[model samples]
Target: MEYDFTLKYQLAADDCDLDQIVERLAEAGCDDATIGVGQPGRVALVFAREGATALQALLSALEDVKQAVPSARLVEAAPDFVGLTDVADVAGVSRQNMRKLMLSHAAEFPIPVHEGNPSVWHLSDVLTWLNTRGGYDIKPDVLEIARSAKQVNLAKEARELEPRINQQLEYLLA
Candidate 1:
């Protein structure tokens, strides 16, 4: 079976250039790896395998890279999924608060579904909602109000600002 593996490494402050790391990995026989810049100073490498031996080779290459860059961290490697959930895990808020947020902010929250009801949200949908909603800071009402106000103000400001902005641009160009 084919499998995808993701390896993450955090670079030190001085080691910001990733070309060297990529070169090292390539030299170590990891030619088919895709490298990307992640949040802040982290780098991510994605590798694919066709069998257990290929996976082992990838792991060994990763280990070699890790030894060369001791600051790099091996975060995780798993199958990709659309969503995930842990019902009892509520670290960002108290259990009661989480329940309150769920109850009061139904519009902002992803709709939960009953097993028998197809109209209900899919597990993936609920998980997507939870992940997004969990990180959201504004209240539902506040968000609505802010959004409406922003629309109104933007329309008004655009009408007023466009002429002046255009004049400035014309002046700069001239």
Candidate 2:
């Protein structure tokens, strides 16, 4: 099954020209990918691919970007949902500590987008919260993995709904 993923990279240098990077990526086969400059001088790269694991997608994306923009460095790739374990890892804390921090700041912490055994929150939101609180340094590789996972999940969901959406359209046209 195909997966959708968004990988974020931090622009390594302040003077790095984004326009040049975008042109390079476009020429290197990531034409459909998105390159955005976000909070804390980050360049977020988002792409969707099918037929490989999330990690594979991440690697492929990185390879593509490297080919286009050798200096651009990915900084974050957190998926839409991440368990406490992953969150804690990103936050550089024990899972238990992460839980305690969440509990202590219940009102402020971004609520998980999805609730389950290990509730997950959007990578951007979580990192923003943590960065604001001066708790952790959001890492790029971690975000890349999260982005890949989230993309894959999104792709799967989209694929599942394709048939129904087509049927509805056909019915309306008929």
Candidate 3:
């Protein structure tokens, strides 16, 4: 018997800030994962499998991603198996980097769906690995610069509206 499964996800604000979702999927026993942008704040994942126990593996994978990235909204779909290269694209990392990370710590990487052939990394595994490593912090000056920029933009917007407000007042008087 063959078991095929798919899972999609919509990420929340906090979830967007990290790659934990991908890492978690890998831990759950899924193989061949792909992620894509849905709406502005949504992320979709498609996982595939082929085995008698594929369905059970898929469910385990989904639970893992959900637990790790609580803000993620999941949507299951029909499996459309993708390659490791595809998973790399979704993780925003190069294939080389993915391999390097996995090779560095084999225990941390996801299990391959097939015994032999083009090896594929599960989406959940990638997310779980990412969750283990937190994001980089911004420099203090960079944050200050961002704050200044925001203030400038707000001031410019207010200035632009002032003329319109005056014009409306004049029209009302007339």
Candidate 4:
């Protein structure tokens, strides 16, 4: 099975140059990796690899990124998925409100791409809706910044919650 993983790194808020990191990673044979504008002061690295090769590829990419930006520290790593709270945070609303909005505007809200205990949506789809919702009138540049912030917050929250969620799942399964 092909397992995909996203790794979040703590980047220095002042001197983090993502473009340089990308160039370095590319030179290191991790050309497929991407640096996403995460949170107000962080960046995220995403990798997709298959089987036994996955670990080595991930480690290689991590090493490359760290070399490029010495301040980089692995924050969290996980399989791809975005949670409801992430959507809510991106939308600048409470989770309860987001839930209500999704329910009432079911036709307009993007469907969850990953259906699990928390039901997650694709970041792109949710960002699209957040940027272009009928009455909100959010500008593109503003939305871009907002999207980055949301991504950062979402990644952090997901990392924080992963263990707790796994424990709950284990309890339920048992």
Higher lDDT: candidate 2 or 4? 2
Tens-place lDDT digits, model 4, residues 1-174: 233456787767765666776676667655566668757567776655443444454555567677777777667554324677876665567889778878888999888866768897765566678667655544443344334434544555656667879689669879
- Segments in model 1 whose C-alpha atoms lie over 4 Å from true places: 50-58, 80-174
**Most TM-score-accurate candidate:** 2
Superposed model 3: Cα runs more than 4 Å off: 18-20, 23-31, 79-174
Comparing 1 and 3 by lDDT, which wins? 3
Give one digit per residue, the lDDT tens place, for model 2 in 43-77. 77667654346578666776887787776655545
Give candidate 2 regions above 4 Å deviation.
Answer: 38-40, 80-174
Give the winner by lDDT: 3 or 4.
4
lDDT of 2 at 12: 70
**TM per model?**
0.40, 0.45, 0.34, 0.40
Instruction: State each model's CA lDDT, in order.
Output: 0.51, 0.68, 0.52, 0.62
Please provide, for model 1 over 43-129, each residue's C-alpha lDDT reduced to its tens digit, 9 standing for 90 to 100.
777765443443454456466667667677554332221111222131234546655665687677655543332233332333345
Compare the candidates by lDDT and give the number of the best one.
2
